[model samples]
Target: MSYTYDYPRPAVSADVVVFDSSTDSILLIQRKKDPFAGSWALPGGFMEMDEAADATAIRELKEETGLVVAQVEQIGAYSAVDRDPRGRVVTVAFMAEASTSESIAAADDAADAKWFPVDDLPELAFDHSQIISDCFSKSDKG
Candidate 1:
């Protein structure tokens, strides 16, 4: 079977803001590819055809940082037309808090993965700066 649409379809992606409560740090990955290569960003990527947005978030987090968080809550969705330089991409953001004792290693499309204090972060890629701000604000209240 084949299906096609006359108009363009925006791609869907999932991003996760992982906060280490023990150290008050957030996980960030250095992008290994273009569109923002070498820039720090949240651990996330495009959803797979067979997975839900939430599942994508979890999977991306594990793939990029090797950190397995038990629970992740949806924060919000970002749909800025120019959010992604690759094309029109709509991202669903998820937030989670974990312990800094958990182990992590960079993999997949991430050149490097590390934790940064919420008060101090490197220049971020995409609209991650805004996403982190929003996620942090929500976490602060909870």
Candidate 2:
């Protein structure tokens, strides 16, 4: 079965905020493409048709940062009118914890990958700063 929409729909994506509690740092990637190219961002991408948001988050984390996350929890959803330069994109953000020993490399749309202290991070792309703040809020409550 197939259906088509006459009106435009917001594209959905998932972002992962991988935090290393031991180092008090978070993994961020420098984007290789435009729409904030060269800027730091949480690892993520658009969701595939056969994938759920959680799976997208996990897959993107691995694809962009070469880091395998054991588990991810939904932190929040962000859908601002002009958040994405490409289109109206709504993103579901996920949070995970990793050890300081975990290895990471840049891949896919990532130009570079590294860990930044949570308190001292570079300017982030998209609405990632807000997403990270939301993730921190969620963690404080749990």
Considering every candidate listed, which one attains the maximal TM-score? 2
Q: In model 2, where do residues sit more than 4 Å from their true spots? A: none
TM-score of each: 0.93, 0.95
Backbone steric clashes in candidate 1, count = 0
Tens-digit lDDT string for candidate 1 (87-110): 999999999887777899999999
TM-score of 1: 0.93
Steric overlap count per candidate: 0, 0
lDDT of each: 0.91, 0.92
Q: How many angstroms is residue 14 displaced in model 2 relative to the true structure, after the best TM-score fit? A: 0.4
